[model samples]
Target: MTTDHPRTPGPRPTGATIVWAERVTKTFTTPDGRELPVLDDIGFHLAEGEIVALLGKSGSGKSTLLRCIAGLIAPSSGTVAYRGEPLTGANPGVSMVFQSFALLPWLTVQQNVELGLHAQGVGEQERRERALKAIDLIGLDGFESAYPKELSGGMRQRVGFARALVVEPDALLMDEPFSALDVLTAENLRNELVGLWEGHEAPVKSILIVTHNIEEAVLLADRILVLAANPGRIQAELRVDLPRPRNRQDPHFESIVDTVYGILTGREDAAVAAVEPTTTGGAERPAPTPTSAPLPEVSVGGLAGLLEILVARGGEDGLAEIADELNFEIDDLLPLVDAAELLDLARTEGPRIRVTDAGREFAAADILTSKQLFAHHAASRAPLVRAIVQALAATDGHTLREGLFLDLLRRGFSAEDARRQLDIAIDWGRYAELFDYDSGDGELTLDPGAQDAL
Candidate 1:
């Protein structure tokens, strides 16, 4: 873990480079003699102080790339180098944070954070001091004696982060570190991590994160590397140009999210696949179109049509039954119901759904399906609430209400102000409510109110 920091910046002079992968590739062979290519001539670079995100669906070669860079597995072809030297084995200057938060259950939080230094044969007192400093940097003060079992999920992840920081590696590799946490906690952690990266005046100069979450990628990455599966390869690279502290509700942000969503959902492929050839032509060609024409008057009457259908039906089962009666697929029903739900035009309960108080207001006002309502709901206050609920849901099962706040911190919340926000969400916002806490087992559940909100 302790390696001599390079004196000069830029590429090395000894005919080696900082980190280079020349047409790197990997293939896995099954026992049945079938060969599967996991990576195919993928190439990228990491410059000093740059944060790069590897984004794709599962089996897109993100993990394989990290492992290849770490030298855990040799590439079937291509060369990987560290500091102008070919990496044949594990590289000391690179450290990784796994998604699972791989902490030792038997070890104290401080001890777990200091394990990297311990493995390096650092003296006990020195390791303790370094570990403490790292923990304090992450705002885990006064939790030195806490064991993994006693700490919350978020706290455990913080310990994982502290351990990675204590080593002071030149490059940090994170494999979906925030994906396992709840949305609120993840957002808090993301904010804090960005702040730390901006303020750092240290030797650690580069970061590479692997994730499938489009928002996470856009929020944190300087550049996103999109990979495709079936012999994983770089499909596209997008530079996120938005300024920091990005507003999720911003129109531009929504546009990017939608574009990325399209990419992920295979909608783009479907659109491509839908192209058809012209009949009775020497060469099949696209239909000729007018260069200019008056735009057609657009109306969202379809939404009103949907609302009428929902109102005619009495309950959640009624909505589903109507959908079935009309032969509407789930996808066809989602947008209409979501629109109605967001607009307060409908309320759903278990298998029964109906119009709500706001829906009645819209109907009375004859506001048929204003485009404004769609925008308002799309960029509504619900995202923040949804973010909170998503975080709570990540606990695997139930968790103490206090544990949720701590989990947010571990995901990267500043310990200074997150507690106040948590209180507001639980006490007033109605996003979540405290149920019961057991002092003996530290187990907790959500209140009926919280479940109802969900």
Candidate 2:
């Protein structure tokens, strides 16, 4: 795939600004009454004749930023403007496509596509005509009368696209619109979208897509904004200079993907340069506490699998290559990478992760030896694991209810998240043979030799 049409990267807008967000910050009140910051002073603009991707990991608040741009929600303190007009409610200039098809089950494809037009008070005849055109445009012409349940995942998503496009807004907002489909299906849709945009067939003037897939961002976006987690903020921005219909195997394309991966993994200088030295408002970040330090939700087997792969790759490989080979999104690999790093079993050098000697030995050891090695590392390195061990060790009976830990975790995480954290901790602890959990009793009991591993 290749294209003669070249797009310059960066903030150099080729057309008028369609949507702009300035210093947008969003905060949410958790069920525990804790104020959780999602977006931190985020700012960006979408201009006509461009596709921009908001790229990041799961916690980067990419969707939150997109919602704020759509005027579905107000920023905690900032402004969202559509063509110089500050938004007080839904921005009338844009329509959105969501990951979940979001089609009403009872509505026919035509009815679904006509939803926005109907809401905008379009006349019945005009709405039907336009809906038919959009349905045909999106390749669902014959399926106009088909119910959602009768459509495949791809067809269902096409209905979603038709629904958004039928509105003919100034900008199209997509929140991971292809993530729910199969790889081939997603690729097909992406290529079709690019074709529509390049051929001047798309109704909208600009497109804003939120995604966690690095290659997808490189594939379709003219500009990519890489966001960092922990109060999501823009970490780096890259302008893709490659022509449209990019080939995944192209060196330039692969290089751009690698660069973005580096920025995401904290290896690229661009990320370091974009990162603020202090917290937003110039306030210093607090030191990490046991509860505050999030555990990547990965199992012991998952972490071990990643280490084994690294070892097979001669102890290191570029993150992008690993993800591509394994048919995984970089986001899928992130938690395992995080877990390995947390346990000191792996270390990242730029865009590549290298397994530590400790990791190699653990991988090579027998089952009991592996457990002992893991226990030693878990007790010494993993904060949550160490906290659990220490708490149990200090108790006379060396047993405690799970609720005790969940309570402490709630100070940092929501109730559901707290449980997930504890569950991961329990898995790690049980695998290392450092503790035993009885689910029926909801209790964790320290194993007799737990302290010896520490």
1-454: candidate 2 lDDT, tens digit per residue:
1223353433324699999999999988777687777889999999998899999886689999999999999999989999999999999999999999999999999999999999999999999999988888888878889999999999999999989998998999999999999989999999988887877777789999999888899999999999987678988888898887899889988878777877876664647554445443667778555665678888888888898888888999988789889988776897888778777899887667899999999887888899999999988888898999999999999999999998887765657777998998899999999999999999999999999877
lDDT of 1 by residue, 212-325 (tens): 877788788777777765457876667667766677667776556555544443344422322332234477655321101101111235546666665555423544356568
**Candidate 2 positional error at 154, Å:** 0.1
The number of the candidate with the highest lDDT is: 2
Candidate 1 overall lDDT versus native: 0.62
What is the TM-score (0 to 1) of candidate 1?
0.57
Instruction: List candidate 1 stretches off by more than 4 Å.
Output: 1-17, 201-203, 266-454
User: RMSD to native for every prediction?
Assistant: 17.8, 3.9
For the record, the alpha-carbon RMSD of candidate 2 to the native fold, in angstroms, is 3.9
